[model samples]
Target: MSQSTYTVQGMTCGHCVQSVTEEVGALSGVSHVEVDLPTGLVTITSDSDLSEADVRTAVTEAGYQLAS
Candidate 1:
């Protein structure tokens, strides 16, 4: 499995974390997700080879911005 970390922005509370986490976790190959709302840090675990762009897109679609 491959793992990656993304710095997401605009996560102000638990609900934001849950929103991002659920969106990311729903993606194919995304086995797990850990989101730290205070730091806007998002970690993802996937068995398939998911690209960084895919991760970024997922975050974007979840109404958040991802650090470049």
Candidate 2:
């Protein structure tokens, strides 16, 4: 598996973590997730090729923005 980290903005609490985790983790190739609220870092584990664009889309769909 491979991993990637994304900075997600507009998350404030555990509910935000849950929301982003569920949305991102449900995508194909996603295997695991770690969200760090203080740093706005979301680490994702995937078993196959997954583009950063897809991750950004997932974050956006969950009502957040992926930091560039």
Candidate 3:
């Protein structure tokens, strides 16, 4: 499995986490998602390496932005 961590902006609560999780988790090969609310960190586990663009798109679709 492959794992990557990213920082996200505009996430302040459980609902935010859920939204991001749902969106990123829907990406192909994604196995798990963990969001750390306090730090705005999102960790994704996948079957293969995920493209940064794909993750950014997923995060955007979830109403958040990946920290640049």
Rank order by lDDT, top first? 3, 2, 1
lDDT of 3 by residue, 1-68 (tens): 99999999999889999999999999999999999999999999999999999999999999999999
In model 2, state the lDDT of residue 49.
71
Q: Candidate 3 — which pairs collide?
A: none
RMSD of each: 0.9, 0.7, 0.4
Model 3 lDDT, residue 19, Cα: 99
Ranking by TM-score: 3, 2, 1
Candidate 1 lDDT at 14 equals: 88
Name the runs in model 2 displaced over 4 angstroms: none
Q: What tens digits encode model 2's per-residue C-alpha lDDT throughout 1-68? A: 99988899999999999999999999998999999999889999999878988998899999999987
Error of 3 at 32 (Å): 0.3
* TM-score to native of every candidate shown: 0.91, 0.95, 0.98
Candidate 1, clashing residue pairs?
none
In candidate 1, what are the lDDT values of residues 1-68, reduced to their tens digit? 98888899998888889889988998999999999878898889899878878888888888999987
lDDT of each: 0.88, 0.93, 0.98
Q: What residue runs in model 3 are displaced by over 4 Å at the alpha carbon? A: none
Clashes of each: 0, 0, 0
